[model samples]
Target: MTATIEQPTKVRRPRATLQLLRITLVLHALLIVAQPIAAGYFLAGNVDAMTDIHATIGGSVWIVAFLQTIVAACYTIAGHGRLWPTITSAALVIAEFVQLTFGYAQNFAVHVPLGTAIVTAVVWMTVWSFRSTARLSRREAKR
Candidate 1:
């Protein structure tokens, strides 16, 4: 039997990449929540009680969010996808500042819900934009 290679599907945003982006957004959002909770604990009792887990999670989330930021930029630079590109860029900007301002990666004591809400809203907007743009393009193509 002769073996044949199947060509990979062509897509502006592949399933895996989209899934990764989604996961990164979710993780970052969770960090936004976790940071405030951790701060509450620190305020209530001992600051020493905070563990490396906070830092580790925050760091990993930061990296993931950074990667998504790059992906969003790429999507815009390439000009292949229009809908999510705009939303993603906005979200990335907010996320980057939030991470830096809140000191989420460096310390959990600083929690900024303003930034969190901005990022969260942008994430959902990006998702909605992606779906709407996709549908619009399909419809346009049919005509």
Candidate 2:
């Protein structure tokens, strides 16, 4: 009998939407980390304009959060990834909106603690998204 050659298994890659989600999540995490630094600069009397920069970054975060939410939804539906990412991103959008509102209202009581929570959540998501567990598609997940 003729010898049979075994074909090499194909290496699967993440979908474009998943890749986009990872980019957005990393960007979001970096921005979230910057918020505390910017706030510290303003608090330290280093730069008077840091308040404006802080606010600008906060606004940018809102836009990014919204975009991330959409991408997370797409990843879940089309890419067949987990649904938690979509829920988490949507919650972040709401939380960020609240954070901006309280920040503008000068309610440090809520703003400070909430900012800490948001940063923690974002960092957690960013870390998780990079892990193999988060990369598991529905088929792989079932396996």
- Most TM-score-accurate candidate: 2
lDDT scores in order: 0.53, 0.88
- Let me know the TM-score candidate 2 reaches against the reference structure: 0.85
| Candidate 1: tens digits of C-alpha lDDT, residues 1-143 | 99999997554433444444455556556665565566567678866535554445545555556665776544444534444544555666666567655664554344555545545664564465446343233224245
Q: Report how far residue 68 has shifted in candidate 1, in Å.
A: 1.0
Give TM-scores for every candidate, taking all chains together and pairing residue i with residue i.
0.49, 0.85
Q: Model 1 reaches what TM-score against the true structure? A: 0.49
lDDT, candidate 1, residue 81?
Answer: 40
